[model samples]
Target chain A: MRPDFGLLLINLGINNTVYVKTDPREIALLEGLAKDDRQAIETIYKQHYNMVQTLIINNNGSADDARDVFQEAMIVLYEKARSGTFELNCLLKTYIYSVCRRLWLKRLQQQQKFVSDIENVSETVPVEDELEAHGQRNTEFQMMEKAMQHIGEPCRSLLEAFYIQKRNMLDIAGHFGYTNADNAKNQKYKCLMRLKKLFFAAYKNNTP
Target chain B: MEEMQLLDAVERYLNNEMPADEKAFFEQLRKTNPEVDQLVVEHSMFLQQMDRFSDWKQYKATLHDVHSELLETGSIQEKAPRATVVQLWKKYQRVVAVAASIAGITALTISAIAYYFAPKPASEIQLLSRELANIKRTQTITDKKINALTGQASTRFIPPADPKSGGTGFLIDGKGYLVTSAHIVANADSVYIQNTKGDYFKVSTLYVNKQTDIAVLKIVDNRYQPIKNLPYALQKNLADLGEDVFTMGFPRTSTEIVYNKGYLSAKTGYNGDTTTYQLAISANPGNSGGPIFNHSGEVIGILSGKQTTAEGVVFSSRTRNIFTALHEIRKDSTNEDRIKLLLPSSIKGLDRIQQIKKIEDCMFMVIRY
Candidate 1:
């Protein structure tokens, strides 16, 4: 029975020549990644970080540079997977390698350093569309970050406590020294409006 | 004020915190007023951005944490040091070669002088036997001298000047069986345990397992009284990481039992040994065989040793090893008495002071001669 099942698997592998099938393990990891699971992200980072680190370090990049490029690629993959449009045309390893390569290449060119042919250590996948979407998302995220920086004082901390830390109003009230939750909630609303205005200003400036 | 109220309502509606009737009314208002509908749409988009922004920040934090952890564990390598180290080695080659020869000549000269002055033995086998006999004879003479000085008939005993080794141990069975580190009592002519009150009792080694570094002792002296119950139970299960733990031991320098508290840092010991746990507590020499207790007052592990080069990198033999050792002890039917482990610790709910008061009596200073 085991040999018969093995033969069936071989036939199935032979028949599925046109389309590259995704590994069930990779699918499970990507699904976990979408939910921002720390273990899944850690596993992926442990598995693929060395490959990306080696690629970058071999091409006139330092370990810190390798870390930055790899992390940016991770963000791209994370956002794409979370957006629910990531289709596995290639293995996750190959895709991450390609993304890291493209990201490092762009970084090197931007710095106007002397360029040479980068060694392709793995199979390549065309992730230009995915990268473009990530770029737009990154711009918006940066705008939000800038707005948060300029939001200032207790307001910034207040908004962070509510939105980022996801603390409830009562806890925020006690932590921020508000007499009641209603006062904290009101302060949070005012802070949110100011943050929205600042974010939009950066958004409009970037578009034009 | 009016705009704040509207914004609050819109946020509540977006978060699905609105009541059924109020939500229905809000939906009708959205249909009738294009301005309110636009506000709802805009707020929803902003809320989505906020959600993603939080996630992005959190994911970045996780990546940073994982990177640092992996680096600490040596799972990943940094590239900058390697290139720089190679260049530095090349530049210092001549200087290193010159220093190496000078050091080598100095070491050889020192060894030559030492070898010239060293005593020669008649034969290797005879010398080994003679040295062993000499050590035993000297130890016996010292023991006799100390006993004469202290007067052996007294209930209180003074510690000898030179002991073979010393460590802490605790009672495992109320029937006078105590557990201690095997290294403490592994090779000894006599073993004695002194309580905090300075009362001493002679004990004989019952079983010693060098593999787990655990030894069992039974008090044979008539001066010892068997307690009816032990306050703390030996924990059978593995303890969780980051649980608060405290230990009491007689560090060699201190006469009194020193109490120290720390937490379990890792589930495994040095080099991932499953039978031990890595703790973040600082331990000194003579702290071996001390009981590591959790906050709830159960004996979780036996304090074993510490990494010499690092601070607070202590390792403890897990309490379950005692169980495994006892299983082996039970299999040997020649052992007449049964070693019953204490269960249902009485000190479970007590505060630290009360718990220590009840437990301090069971802790003993093991001195080997």
Candidate 2:
């Protein structure tokens, strides 16, 4: 009775328009399953299994593992919902991703005990917090790269030679077809100024 | 000429290609142009950091792409007919349904038997209600206390006021009034409140606001005393347009409290009913009933609701209304008196009473044990 009331209330409350609505199709399927409708559960698994797999694989997990974790996470969600314990706080996608992320992290942590050289895969990446962080990092990195690209060919060459290749002034002078080391160094200073200008401009554009 | 000469020397020095005499000259250049030198150093470090950042970014993107492709292929290979799970679930449907119906009937029968045979205990019921009110007060106070101690202004993935199941609450009073969203404590049989200092105590009383979906609980045991001389009024008036407001709550049920910075977008009455006010602040479930603060760090409102309708659109209750509710509830015992206090004097007549009755019907008491 407790479980039934819980499930019924959640299902009813969820149906209320005030509770940010999920996909009608999915909700219908979920409802049908709650009412013991078998076809609805099958349709949900068929449609969402790939999406779940994609999320897992994107976060440093293998396809096979993604499938296993996705299935298990779905089963856990299903059980929780069936028992009327699952509260629909977020969109179904967000909830599923969270569950999948947790399962994947657990799997990784277990694997880490056996494998020492596994890279520091961020276990928390599947959550919205990590997603936002990852997005910001990507934007900043892209802005920086674009600025570097916009610095013109001469400045680009100068920066790459001086910073990346660690080439001496004389070698850079020869490479850039300059008159002497002093001229090469002056050109490098001008190029650095141009690069800085481009970088700041791009940073400003991207940030605000 | 001086600027040109200085630039030449700086360039040579940075390239490490300057002759000893020129290097000495460059050393003097550093003193005269310290700002420029500092800028150069910082810029160089920035470039180095960006280099590492780019490398990792590319690596991560490539990994993501590979992962997605692999997952796609795996799904294709493992794709089962859509009807399979549904069929299996449907097959077991009748058995579970019948069992559930029997359980429901039995529960109804037991309740009927108890009502007829065992008279209600009056003192115990009064104690239960009082205890519930005390618990709610404690929960609100505990959440506020935790927010103050952590200096975390925003609410996101804060650990719960109760640490065991990872729910978040705010301390509203030194007397252990903890306020959290009802959803956090909905299923809790026993609740515990923990502070940033890691002190925890068992909480027994719980008061829930089902309409607003807010819950307040209080800790009974005094493992820790409330901070002396703290302000406990509702947050300041609802935020103005674009005014930065902060929410403190547990977003992901994590150990650390999450703080989210957002601005008030729009204000309307609850569900657009106009009887109550709602403020748009970025909040999640665990944030329910936690304090919303302005930049001055004063409570501007309490987070009451959030809607994930379109991306980035969230709703919160205005502090003024929540304050009114709390004030009326604290001051009055009878529903009539509470409604009289809550509504304006002009709206306290017979017709008004009927309307108040409707509102009361919509309001359900949330009980958390």
First chain of candidate 1, TM-score: 0.86
lDDT string, candidate 1, B184-254, tens digits: 99889999998898777889998898877888999988768889989999886789999999999999544
Candidate 2 residue-wise lDDT, A1-208, digit = tens: 2666778898987556454446665566556644545455455555666666666555556667766676555444544455454345446666666667666665777777343333333222234453354346557767666767887787887877886667888999998899999889788778777776766676767761
Docking class of 1: acceptable
**Clash count list over all predictions:** 0, 52
lDDT digits (tens) for residues B1-369 of candidate 2: 465565555555765878998778767766798776785575655665455544444434443444455456663444433355575677799988999999999999999998998856997799899999999999999999998967874422223343434446655554555656556577777776555434446665446665655665666764545443333234544456677766565555433455676876665644574323445556665555566655554555556565556555666545565555456457655532221111222222234234233222111112233
DockQ, 0 to 1 scale, candidate 1: 0.32
Top candidate when judged by TM-score against the true structure: 1
Q: At residue B172, what lDDT does model 2 achieve? A: 52
Question: Cα deviation in Å at residue A67, candidate 2?
Answer: 55
Q: Which ranges of candidate 2 are over 4 A from the true structure?
A: A1-208, B1-166, B231-233, B236-238, B269-285, B332-369
The reply for model 1, stretches above 4 Å from the true place, is: A1-19, A114-116, B81-369
Error of 1 at B68 (Å): 0.9
